[model samples]
Target: MTVRTDLLIVGAGPTGLTLGIDLARRGVDALVVERADGLFPGSRGKGIQPRTMEVFDDLGVLDAIRAAGGSYPVGMIWQDGKRVGEHRMFDPAEVTEDSPHAEPWMVPQWRTQEILFGRLEELGGQVAFGREVVGLTQDEDGVTVRFPAGESVRARYVVAADGGRSAVRRAVGIGMTGETVDPSPMLVADVRIAGLDRDNWHIFPPHGEGDGFLAVCPLAGTEDFQVVARFPEGASVDVSLEGIRKVVAARSHLAPDDVTEVRWASGFRPRAALADRFRDGRVFLAGDAAHVHSPAGGQGLNTSVQDAYNLGWKLGAVLRDGAAAGLLDTYEEERRHVAADMLGLSTSVHRGEVRRGEATCQLGLGYRESSLTKETRATPGAVRAGDRAPDGNLDGVRLFDAFRGPHWTVVAVGVEAPVVPEAVRVVRGRALESYGCGVFLVRPDGYVGWAGDQTAGGLGYLGRFGGR
Candidate 1:
C-alpha cells in the first residue's frame, strides 16, 4: 500500500502526535505512523511546565487538561522521609501578569498522550498503529518512507519523533552525541502503596542498608503513586513486583509486603544524549529522537511537545504559504540549542542541585536565528531576544484577545516604521517594551522574530524568508 501526505511524522508519541494535531488544525494533511498498537502505559514525565500550558492553551486543549488531572502548585523536597524544601510553581513576583497561564500542571505522560491523541482525532488526523518506519529515502523534492507492513509513504517533509531508540534517526544517519551519565539503573514502577503519601513527590536518599534512592510521585486519577528507585552502580535487580518490594523495603522503613498491586514496571539506564544535528534535507528530528536526558526535572516529554509546537507552524507555513526553504532550517538552529540546554539542566538536577526558579530549560529557549530577528543594541535580559515572547494586553484590548489563534503578529511601536504588510497583522501600541522594542514580528508558534528597530534595507527581514 502507498499513501501521500504533506508531512509524514515517523512516530506517534507526544511530539509527533502534537505536530500532527497542529498541522491538521491548520488544514494541512499529515500522516503519523506508530509501532505501538495502543496508547503508551507507564509514568514517564509527570510535570507539565507553564510554558507548555501556554502552548496547550494556544491549541485550545488547556481546558481539557484542566478538566483531567491537573498540576498542584506546591511540591516538596525530601531526604529520608524528612522534608528539606518546598517549591511553589508560580512566583507572582518573578512572573508578570501579562502571561496568561503562568503555573505548571502535573499529569502522567500517558494521560497527556491520551489528551493529545483525542485532540488529534478531533482535528481529523489518526495514527497508523502497528506500523513502523523500516526505511527512509529523501531527495530534493520529497521523502520516501517505508514501513514494516509493506507500506510506503511519500511526503514533502518527515519528522522523526520515534523515541530515544529512534529508527528513523538512525536511518537518516544522524549520530547521537553525548556521554551516559551515571547509568543509574533504576526501576520505575506504578503500583498501589499502602502508606505512601499521595500529595507530593517524595525523594528518599540512601539512608543505611538500601542500595538505591526512592522517588515517589503521585499519579493523577488514582490513589496509587509512581515509584522510581535507582539501584547501586552496576547492581542488577529484577523489575517485577517482588523486586520492587525488595528495593522499597531496603530503601524505606516500609515492609516488603506493604506493596500490594504492581500496575507496571520497567528498568532503564538514564542517559544524557543529543543528536549532533536536528535536520538533514527533507528529514527532521524532534522529541526524544533529537535528545534524551535523565527525567530529573520532568522535562523529557514537555521538551518534546514544545519541539513539535515550534516546528509544526514553520513546516505548515512553508507547505501552505510558500515560505522560503530557509525558514525550515531555523527549526534546527532554534531547537538544537534547546536540546543541549535540556541535556545540561537535566544533568545538573541529577547531580543533586535544586533548580529553583523558572526552569531555564523551559523559559530561556528562543529563536534568535530567524531572519526576522531584528538588530538591537539592547543588552541581554533587557530585551527578550530569542525567548518566548511575553503575552500582554494592548490597552483597551482584552487579554489573549490578540494573537489568540494561530497567526503571525507584527507589533510596530514607533511611527517611523514601514507600512505594515497585510500578510502580517499590525497592532499599534506604545508598550513595545512589554514584548521588546521596535517592530516585533512573532511567528505563529509564539516565538519572537525581529523585536528591535526595523531596517531601511527594503524590509530585508521579510526577504530572508521570502516573505512579503
Candidate 2:
C-alpha cells in the first residue's frame, strides 16, 4: 500500500512532532512516522532552555510543559561522604518583561516527547509507528519513499528527523564532517535511589588514580534521580542496574542498596557533527539527522526543536500560500549556519572551554545574517532586522499575545508604519526598550524579518515573502 501526503516527516522525535503541530495548525497536511513502536524511553535530554519555553508558549504547549517540569536544582559537591558546598549550575538570571523565561527547566526527554506527541494529536496530526524509511527517491515534482515491508509513500517534500544515524540521510548521500569531543565513555540512567536529598545535584569530582567524575541529579517532577558517570579512556560502560548501583556506591558515600530501582540506562561517547547540506531536491534533514551535538550544555534537543520551528512556516508558505519556491531555499541558508555555530558551542561546553551561561539559554541567538532579513534604516536601534522579537506591552496589548499564531505582524514602534496586507496583523504602539523606534515586520517564528525607520522599501520587503 502507498500513502500520500503533502509533507512526510520521518522520525517522530521532538523535531518531527513540533513541525507536525506547526504544519497542522497552518492547515498543511503533514505525516510523522517513527520506526520504534513508541516514543524514546530515556532521560538523556533533560534540560529545556528558556528560549524553547518561549517557543512552547507560541505552540500552545507552555501550560502543559510548565505543569510537567520544574526549575533545575543547584549543584552540591561531595567529599569523603560530607557535603562540601553548593554549586550553582546555571548563571543567575532575573525574569523580566523582555525575557519572561530566564532559566532552564528540568523535564526528561521522554516526558517532553509525550507532551509534544499529545499536542500533535490535538492539532489533528498523525504519527504512524512501526514505519521505517528504508529507501528514498526524489525528483522535480516529489519524492517516493519505500519501507522495509515494501509499503511506500509519496510526499511533496520529505524531512529526515531520524536521529544521528539517519537512514534517509545516508540514502540521499549527504556527508557529515565531525570529530569526537571526549575520549572517555559516559553512562546515564534514570533510577530510584535512597539516602540522597533531592534538593541539589550531587557531584563527586574525579578521584584521580583512574576513577572518573560522577554526578547524581534529581529529576524534577518525578521520583527518579538521573545518574551520570564517566569511565577511563578505552573502557566499556556497563548499563545494567547492578552496574549502576555499584558505580554509585563506589563514587559517592551511598551503598549499593541505596539504589532501590532502575528504570532505564544507556551509554555513549560525546561527539559533534554537522551535515554538509540541510536540503537535497525535495528532501530536507532536521534534528540529529542534520547536526549531531554532544549531550552537554543542554543544546541538542532545544536546537532541534527550533530547527522545526524555523522550517515549518516556510514549508507552509511555499506549499499552501502560493509563495515563490525560492523561499524554501532560505531554510538551509539560515538554519545551517545556526546549526554549525551551535555544534561549536556544544563542543566547547563538553570540553570545559566555555560555561553553560547565557549562550546555552539560546536567547541571544538570531538570524542577523540571513538573506531574508532587511535592515534599511541607516542607524538601526537596539533591536534590528533578524533579531528575536522581545516580549513586552505595546498599545495596551501584550506583544507575544499579538504575535501568537500563523500570521505576520507589522508593528509600528514610535513611528508611522506602512500598511501591510489585510492578511497580516497590525499593532500600533509607542516603542519600549523591548523594541526600538522603527517599523518591525515580525515573522511567524517570532523574529523581526524587516526593520526600517519609514515606509520606504516596506512593501518591497514584504513582497519577497508573499506579503503584499
Q: Distance (Å) between predicted and true CA of 129, model 1? A: 0.7
Which runs in model 1 stand beyond 4 Å of their true positions? 72-95, 101-103, 354-356, 369-372, 376-381, 414-423, 452-468
Off by over 4 Å in 2: none
**True-structure lDDT of candidate 2:** 0.91
**Total clashes for model 2:** 0
Backbone clash pairs in model 1 (N, Cα, C under 3 Å; residues 3+ apart or in different chains), count: 2
Give each model a TM-score. Answer: 0.89, 0.98
Clash count for each candidate, listed in order shown: 2, 0
Q: With candidate 2 superimposed using the best TM-score fit, by how many Å does residue 68's alpha carbon deviate from the native?
A: 0.6
